[model samples]
Target chain A: MSSNSSFPKNEISIIRGKCLVLPGNDIDTDRIIPARFLKCVSFTNLGGQVFADDRSELKGAHPFDQKQNYGASILVVNDNFGCGSSREHAPQALMRWGIRALIGQSFAEIFYSNCLSLGIPCATGSEHLIKDLQKTIEADKSQVWELNLKHENIKSSENTFNLTLETGPLKMLLTGKWDATSQLISQKKNIEKTKKSIPYLSNFDITN
Target chain B: MSKGTLYDKVWDIHRVADLPGGSAQLFIGLHLIHEVTSPQAFAALEEKNLPVICPERTVATVDHIVPTISQKRPFNDPLAEEMLSTLETNCAKHKIKLFGIGSGSQGIVHVIAPELGLTQPGMTIACGDSHTSTHGAFGAIAFGIGTSQVRDVLASQSLAMNKLKVRRIWFDGQLKSGVYAKDLILHVIRSLGVKGGVGYAYEFAGPAIKKLSMEERMTICNMAIEGGARCGYINPDQTTYNYIQGLPHAPNFEDWTKAINWWQTLASDTSAIFDDEVTFDASQIAPTVTWGITPAQGIGINECIPTSESLETNERLLAEEAFSYMDLKPGKLISGIPVDVCFIGSCTNGRLSDLRAAAAVAQGRHVANGIKAFVVPGSERVARAAEKEGIDRIFLEAGFEWREPGCSMCLAMNPDKLIGRQISASSSNRNFKGRQGSAHGRTLLMSPAMVAAAAIEGKVTDVRKMLGSIK
Candidate 1:
């Protein structure tokens, strides 16, 4: 879990893993990575610290601590998963802890964007659909599953489920343009032009 | 699809390019940075060999990690010191204005930005902290970003962002005397659920919103993230102009009228159309308090926590989880719950107005026996102002430890934290487990005045009972 995967700065349309189920709703970023652990200059050691508070409180009974869920890189969670704070540390921790994608009832906006930037596709599904998927994984922890953002579906050998994501983000994941700094930087001319047009940016001077 | 709303106008105004992914590259008019989230972003920029394209637009501050009890040269906590030093080194290297500790303007980024008038209307502001929405009190469209986006902003001065749908939250009437903006926001979250504002920029409008002071408006917008709205804003008015008029970064006298005219035009037109509209009656809101980890799980001071069977099927699981995590029984009254600690600070409610409201409550009252109660101003300016008004003296006399300015006990990144399972009556925003430092620590979110009242009682007490109509 501590190994840094060479960030494949390319299309992440497909994510394969054994689904790990974490039940309950509004599972905030604080629970994902508690604020106490966020006192670092780097996110390198965050993998071992993800769910530090919850896992410690559960005393080895938490899903992340369970042996059956090992190698589970696709997390199955309930509603409002990753709901508090804008700490990218939450998604970075999950990514470093072996999660490649997330399927939840919903996700907080900032947390979702953080995951997208990290190339972790957060797919959403209907309540019934997500619960069914979570139960399926719980009943058979070893079953391998694959989420295809290109086709917008999650599939195991025996089952396939539909998931929903915004088209704009879908395009980003499919086009490997999720890493957006280059794209933004590439529009240097427009950036300057836009900055010049903003009144406050130029101290309200439009002429100069 | 929203038309003529501030969010729409600001988004269009800042659009630099139509990104291929259907997202727009929008220029960040004001880029705010803080110690906790910017370090990694700076590291990424160095790793990528990129230069900060618009260093002038970015303003740095040290808040999330600084100790509220001490403002020494190097922080006592080694890791906290390292984090702050990393920010100092990065800001120095980038030539961004670092409002380091003791830079009279240093405080919570959200607090200082607005206080110094760096936050203005018709701007698209972005910061790495979720409470960045606090700047929206000036009618600016602001949002919280992650470290990667922070890096993106550093490299390009912009973000590839999808324009958010606008939801005008119309408030009718005025907030009752005892109720404040914090109560209103908590009540809204409680009614709407924590995820209600996802993908939507909340437009806090109508008569109730208009009547609030700019600082009060900031408190309401500050917790927009708590309800899943990355951005929440109030349109600028004369109140906004008055607040920014004399501040350090406000437009100069020559540009004041021009700035006001431009700000006036940015408000939502009378014929504006929104993606959705939700209305609330301000008079209906009470001194709301959270009884659960998520901000949405709140009840009016007089209300009892609902049993699982009483909630909707979708809300039941979280309700059960809340009951256990908070160690409270179903149908228990939220008021009268004993608290071991009381904290009054955070980006959400640490402004001078918040302290004044709390100080008004603590004027002649003493904190309950054995309660560890403290007050931390949002910024040095707020601290100085409170001291000038003898508000700090009032708190100290009432047995509340008046401390320095920082985001203390809110996220608990510094040493100011709770000891084991201690439930705090906090004026901070989030009430999440371990949020105030201890792994099992509990937090009951309320108005600062309510936190003051709770400090007096060593339990969750309704501020309305103690209020002699301060407003």
Candidate 2:
């Protein structure tokens, strides 16, 4: 979304929402938000263009375009989601489109970090478990899914799937340290100290 | 402590602190910024009232939105003009050096850095662009960060990042003529798959890599991000030093010896251990081209498009999708595919040497009728060098548009784009769907010489065969 919205900055221990399953692997950033839509000065209104080409091509056949999945807050996808281009628009578009959490077999390193910075936890599960969850969610669009980060598990009516997140991101999401700028600012003194030690930095005239 | 890899040594030296989590606060030695990703970052800084902690450490340029054909002031596209003006304003406000239009040093962020000697060995470079790994050619630990991370770097001159596992990608022997660094990286990606390098920093080493020129090494590391590595680098050596010796921003003559001595120690120790090791024979690689959406879905120029049966179960669906999207038949030979456009530019292959290689192929030949071909230099300096060497005249005589420096058609942020379903043989990186500005445009990624050959034939012809014909 706009990122300036009053979304909670921390306390992402648990989340409950409808899951929209998008079956595909290596769904790159280009597909998440096509390059054409990346020309805007700001990321606002990107939700409408999320999967713009795919949705137009599929003509409402894509899960995201379907009426039943209109307000889905969680997305379940196959392996290696968000694989190309380091466009932050991918996660921004998804977040604007109402996705608050993502569960997939894997995610591109940069994409995962971008999502985490927005307080969106990208958890991973085994293929079978993810597929089963996707199928179950597809069968009933209204089914509620519970993602418990504290316990590292996702539960639907019929099954509970184990999800895993790296400890670094997990802590960042939990404590709102996801905003590295804040932490960096708090450590300004230390950073300055280190900056002075770098020979190249000393070459620059740093007034701050 | 035991010996460490180049990545380890660089990481250890730049690491400012180990954060509460397992991540490290890494001091960024050079921060390169372009028009597209920095506007939001500067906006964030403005919103927070944070002055750029170290403006001298950061350099700005306008690339993605600058039109290669007509880069005159007040671009036809209002948005492009706005982006450029915004960058100029931000850089002026923060006192960051910007290589704007007409600045001889201005070019794609990746291309200008090394040539200016702003990119150095053992440095930690960060840019708000994914291809920032291109600087790793100098043995630097480089990373591509998002706009927010760009903001983080601007505010603190550091980035909080998780340490990546080191992977040694050893290649032996010598690359055959006509096989370039693009092919080698394509071969590596094809073998490892796109996601194989996730959570790792690839250290490209061995006899083959040692033989490549600095620009060629940059080409190899440029696409490392395409294979899912956060970054990729080669060990700096005498070649690296020679490239840096007298450049504008390089160490002065008095400091040169001391700088060389320090850089020599930045390479990985012979006994350094890695988290993973993979090897390939240079002889095994050939002139390669990507037929599918991802860089990993490539085949040798002489090879055929793979059928679903030939792919792993997980790869079949995407392959099938690619077949349909590209309007290509499975098992069809990649060489004979007709091309409508041939582009030689972008940070991946728009260097001076790339232009020279393409110019050699286009010396007496002309672009095929009805096929559009163009060459955009990686930077203004590259363009000037090509012009001085008469490479631009050769390309122009060959009926290719010799254009200004900018990231043209690479992501197609400007007006240069493939209209309709025209298939392109492009030297630029990424063959993603609609990556060349047309929703249905198809891109076949290849080397500049191969693109030159493809332009002449209006088909995906092998450069080696064309070389013989030219001789």
Candidate 3:
């Protein structure tokens, strides 16, 4: 493994942690971070409040509230997780809560993109494999899980599941091309040229 | 050259470049920013020492956190004031146009954009708000992006996006009276599960859609995101052209005809292919209401709450969760469910037409004694128009408090909210748990007219039953 000090700032090709299995499908953005908490000026300190209402309602029974899952960095969920609202806070709250990667049956498109933008890799596996992996993690909470993005495999001490990521986002994660802002800045000259060609944009002046 | 669908034409015209991956960089034609999602994005741009590349393409408005009761300087909620001031500072720094409170144009971003004619056929609109899809009513490709994506748009006037498959949702028959556009969309979302449109852009079509007013079309498109679509659009026609002809920001007379011709070409060719299609009979739709948390978990007002057996195996768990959260009993009739609050406003149903519909219902009837009712306009212009039409007086006479324009009681960012476990008949979008401020507060989503009916009856009453009296 590469030294921690040498970790790339823009891409994550691998992640290792004890997996925390959240047993539910369509675990929407509102549950990930309640609308109440979204009023904050910044995303900072949102880690502590991720799943705040759900955890409270469950009375410490939520997987994330359990002591064994405290530092778990990989989150495994059922199909269609983060399915409602285009709230980026959902992924931001998860990332801040120490989740470095997500493996599930599937994820909502916007949520997947938000996670990818943050250099967090979200992968998928068949329902059977995902459920089996969740069971393995639950039976022994201490088992370390490793997600190898380059090889498309997720492994635990007793099991290995084949994982798949969309080719577009996978390439973006591997090559650090997910940072669209930087890419946009680099192509400024071309954008300026485009702006000049569009009559509506070229003729737009604040004075007018 | 291949004849393209509306989505393809818009996508191709806006595409800046193909990125390293299978994503395309799309130049945004308009960027609408609001108080809630823009602060962090502006801060990020500041950190990167980046200026807004094309400030003219971006427009700023304060909506989410602004209090509807009193929108004076130094807002009662310090956080709300700070958010507004931050937007003011950012817009001033970047030379971006801002419709701050008291500006005649100030309103919900989605509502004001169309009213100002900033949303047009064949344009690509991006906003840091979920209801950005509301603009797609004008035949534009609109996206609701996250704050980071907002920063990307502000810094480069473009966004990197993977193309979406197109799905044509065609309505086969005319809507029955009392079945509003809100009901039509609610029916669509319920029939097609919440996750059905995950990777698609929906094209709303058929004779029923073409017959809708621009405002009604906007109401339908506003909740396209609720059905999990990336965006939704309607092909421009005479109705679209007529609506944009006189708007201040629309193309002048010299370019108007040319613009209309180009917009007409953006519609799907007769032989255009679609990845998927769904057809709905609009005649069957009634005034709809969400009994559970999700927008999809809705039924006709007269229908009973869905039984577990009626739900798919995977949806059962969420249904149970919603049942518990909403304090609703499975298989119980959705009608006569007592409502403690009646809220008539949101980006989804706070436009002028929505206000007129609600006012029509409230003309002579008084709100029930125990029900707390309020009517909020979507924009300052809407508020003014309502006042001019005596619609505000009708609401006031009906005992519904008429308030200033903003996103009030929608997400409950401001002072207006449901007190503890109060069930609300809300004209807003989204019925997610605690979405209306109180952790236990419950919202039942419906049309503005339905909400007005609920206020008068003090329960879930059919808008159709009250329509005869109003007429």
Candidate 2 retains true contacts at a fraction of: 0.49
Top-scoring candidate (lDDT): 1
Best by TM-score: 1
Comparison by TM-score, 1 against 3, better one: 1
Interface RMSD of each: 1.9, 3.8, 3.9
- Candidates, ranked, lDDT: 1, 2, 3
| Candidate 2 local distance difference test against the native | 0.88
Which sequence of candidate numbers ranks them by DockQ, best first?
1, 2, 3
Candidate 2 structure, TM-score to reference: 0.97
lDDT (Cα, tens digit) per residue for candidate 3, span B1-471: 223789998887777888886788888999999887888999999899989988988999988888888898999888788888989999999999999889899999988999998889878899987788899999999978888999999999999898899999999889988889999999999999778888899899998998999999999889888888879899889999999988989987777766776777789988989999899999889899999988999999889999999988878988998998898899999989999999998899999999999988898999999999999899998999989999999999999999999898888878987888999999999898878888789999999999999999999999898887324
**Chain B alone vs. reference chain B, TM-score for every model:** 0.99, 0.98, 0.98
Tens digit per residue, CA lDDT, model 1, B345-389:
899999999999999899999999999999999999999999999
lDDT of 3: 0.87
Q: Where does candidate 3 chain A have its weakest 10-residue lDDT segment?
A: A1-10
Whose lDDT is higher: candidate 2's or candidate 3's? 2
What C-alpha lDDT values do all the predictions have? 0.90, 0.88, 0.87
Against the true two-chain complex, what DockQ does each candidate achieve?
0.73, 0.48, 0.44
Candidate 1 global lDDT: 0.90
Residue pairs with backbone atoms closer than 3 Å in model 3 (clashes)? none
Q: Runs in model 3 with CA error above 4 Å?
A: A1-8, A197-208, B1-3, B469-471
Interface RMSD of 2: 3.8
